[model samples]
Target: MTKLVKPVIDQVWLLRWWHRHQAQRLNREADAIRNGLLQDLFAVRRQLELLPGSGGLAAVEHLYQALDALGNRLSSPYLHDSLPLAIQQALADWPPQVPTRAELPSHWPAEPVEHTLLLLAVLNHLGQALAAQPSLPQVCAVSLTAGSDGQRLTIAANYASAVPPALLELDQSEAWRAYLATFDLFSQGRASSAHGATTLRWAFVW
Candidate 1:
């Protein structure tokens, strides 16, 4: 019995290949979705009561709002930038764009809920309603803090309350409807769906 052996000449590592494909980070089409659709939804948070500004929320504030709205107090809206390829592509096909730090022309989703959670969580976590204070995480934005909680997710600041009308319309679009349909939180709640006994219950204020 004989075993064949090949000599390793200047072995190349996985890091080299990883960095090679990571060259182009920005996806203009994804950027278009964010600037076009994601930011606009920022204004919708104004409709929420007892939280913060009712006029409109800035990009950074919207980021926080999106987080809380998704039901997880501890999660990273900034991580949306590094989402799996499949989730990215699902968002790209979402008709309207999603405002995100990572902008990609095409990406797919490992789980549709992951993409939706990223989108909704960012806006829900918005703290204030001002645009002057730009805290929204961008593509280059990475983990500046070790924790992903209230004080951890953001530092204190005031955000502008100017409404971006164009973005809101997309939120109401049938396409957005399709997008939201992919997530469960946005789903109509079932009496049995409560998150255990400790879960805070709310009375709808109509």
Candidate 2:
């Protein structure tokens, strides 16, 4: 009877040790995630400070959208879904006054939730750019194209007139560039005159 009791005690001790070890590992991972969230918050705040006076309202709205996205990401860190569908949903959510025409493929490979959120941020910036135009056209067009390799995506927004220099300045800022670089995304913008109109073009690849 004494020998049997010793084995049982040893089994219980091993089980408790394993549980403690797993708890410690999970705690470490949680701490790392918390630190990341804090860093993102700081970056958003810095971006807000860089906005011009005319863009104050738009910047505030962008910050709120980012916070909402982060909250959703925190709740479900590993979400995977289609990127095209996400962009469509964002376009649908836009205010009725802003007429937008979107051209997106029916389907594409799904990506991590955080990636989708970052793409949404880019879309928000484009929308703000369209809004900043002194006289918005009857319709603005947004087109998205994906590379054959499935490793690259492009978003283009065509505005009726040249976008405000102040709005473009935000996109050219060091903070904005760094934020996109942190996610391994690259972007560039150009302005061209054709016929009698100017078009602001921005290209993003990841």
Q: Candidate 1, which ten residues in sequence have the lowest lDDT sum?
A: 197-206
lDDT of 2 by residue, 1-206 (tens): 45544446565456545644553454345445545764675666678677775456566567656655554433223224567776776666555666877777787776644455566665665566556656554565666676653344444444446555664665677755655553442222222212223444544554
Model 1: per-residue lDDT, tens digit, 1-206?
99987765533434333322332122333444455555555545444544666443455476645544332223223234533343333333322322333333233323223333434333342212112222321111111122232111111211134223432343355644443342223223111111222221111100
TM-score of each prediction: 0.20, 0.47
Instruction: Please report how far candidate 1 places residue 85 from its true position, in Å.
Output: 7.8
Model 2 misplaced stretches (Cα beyond 4 Å): 1-79, 149-152, 185-197
RMSD of each: 20.8, 16.7
The TM-score measured for candidate 1 stands at 0.20
- lDDT of all predictions, in order shown? 0.32, 0.54
